[model samples]
Target: MIPLRLKIETDAIEPYVVRLRSFEGISDESHHTGALDAALESASAETAEFSGATGNLRLFGVDPSEVNGDVLFVVPSRGTAHRLIRANSRHNTLLVTERCDQLCLMCSQPPKKQHIDMFPFFETALLLSQKNSTIGISGGEPTLFKSELFDFFNRAMSRRPDIDFHVLTNAQHFDRADLPILRRLDLTRILWGVPVYSSDSDVHDRIVAKPGAYDQVRRSLSLLCEAGAKIELRTVLMKPNAPGLLDLAKFVTTALPFVDSWAIMQLENIGYARQNWDTLFFDSSTGFDIVGKALDFAISRGIDTKLYNFPLCTVPTDYRAFAPSTISDWKRAYVADCADCSLRNECGGFFEWHPKVHGYERFGVA
Candidate 1:
């Protein structure tokens, strides 16, 4: 049986659905769209046997013990997005090396060019593992140490098979050596986070500081897709990549069919981003409109996407997100706008420095 993901439109509605699922064996459920009053309690000790629950779908209080025991594999909530996140609220990312092939302007970390060994890094990660483990092997580029990454995964998998893995790599590392690693790693438990700046290679390579980065991306993309590794194309949407937004969306939709999702992030005011904010960052003025258009295009293409840093109100209707609309829109800051905005209470708002760059006027009547 396939994993079932339930979708409930609103947070308010999630609870009631949870209540309804507590009953034994719900039959003839209504296939409805949109959010409702949602209630969720802790799972009951009395487990129900079921299977195949995933993706925008909730098991509500459905027990995983029930799931493992039964062949059915998943007892699904009628319509909720599958929350695939592991129950344990921890993630481990081992910095494989400081050495990066690229000089991305937005990198939060200082430049690391010398290749670092993996033995100590691997040991630390192993020590940090708890029951439900999700680990990301990050680096200037993890693939740079293709041999080390493969070896570490083999060791990690031997000890824990259920562990979910996220391999952060610049698609540039796809080569014969890398193939063996891809072959050895199980796809179900792994998510390859590959940074793809814009659909255009020129834009992507420019960010990576490697001129031929695009060629590597193209070849590796084919290999990653062929290997069936679940891939999430991490596209950092910035002022430079902004012009190619529509093209990027269409490119992903058309070219990277194997990609599981795309993370369209706004340039954060960190690392290279801080230095390049005037040139790279975008607030509501021109940035918001462009992002809204790109996002709309992505949705139209039936592409799965995520918006980070941007506030909620600034986003168009197509974007299904919980983030604030503008940098200045967040409540965390002691900014001037929050006092008058009706959304202040519910909104998570934006980063503290938002108002410093894109001030209150951008989010008018706030």
Candidate 2:
């Protein structure tokens, strides 16, 4: 089994073998968790120690192994959640901000009015991140951070020049005023994942609960593309957007032809999605025909396409390869029957939060 990416808020990290290491081999004093040789014998959530050559470090139950790497422990808070910022780990994604400008009906992390500056946390995370890793800057909306975000990006890129960034934004904040900043940044490695719900502005705006959002997103995409930044168009499959999925695909192939890739993702049943389940949830077992049509159309047009969070058996054999294991381990789950599935290794399993309102009756051996 692959090693767990990062452990957080757990009472104990013991019994689970982990190779904790810094992005740079050198140990920094700020994250020192000294020698664990003696700490492991009586390790507990309240008190435990991990000893390294650098010094004796105190931490929860983390069983270290001879992984041939220097360890870096990031204690982001006063509490005992030691987040291992794995710069070398492929699953690393920096969640920059939880505040969003758009109130999308199906938002996984709903918008909040609280004023919180997550830059400090992000700055530390980015600095500790692995060089040459594909770093994702996501949020309720990352663009809301504006100049602060740009500064963070600038600093992070300078520290790890080989790092690539993938930012998820609604693209509502992109305009002429932001063009200068966009041009100055290292956008070569940055892939902006922007959402386009539908070609029709009204339909798109309605879904996001922002009246002029569609127009703004359209403008944002054009501006970002003009700035030579790589852009990936995303569309979340749901009831409102399903009817117009094909239309959106057509519009994307024609209007957004410059987009590097198009990702059609399954809905994560959480946050605001739970509130609007009856309205947004569509049983993919039968409703996937529409999705299939849209994917078919996009493929016919030579668009670089990806299907995310989709069950392997639900997608046609031709599109099965396109469905990668997109679900993160923290939230991914598989039904009991999946134990016998030959293609289970290749499939992206269900989200743990799935209420099973739409049963997995369609899932079977491929």
Best by TM-score: 2
* TM-score to native of every candidate shown: 0.65, 0.83
lDDT of model 1, residue 297 = 73
Give the alpha carbon lDDT tens digit for every residue of 1-366 in model 2. Answer: 234333333233332222344323344553443232122223454544444433334554344332223223333243333333443346656666778888988898887767566666566555545456786778888888788988888887777888788889899887788788888888897999999988889989999999999988888889998899999999888888889999999999999899999999888889999889878976666677788888889989989888999889877787788899988765788877678888999998888887764454576777
lDDT of 1 by residue, 237-319 (tens): 77678888878888888887668877777665556777777777655444566767767777678777777665545554345
Superposed on all Cα atoms, model 2 deviates from the true structure by an RMSD in Å of: 5.8
Compare the candidates by lDDT and give the number of the best one: 2
Model 1, C-alpha of 289: deviation from truth (Å):
3.3
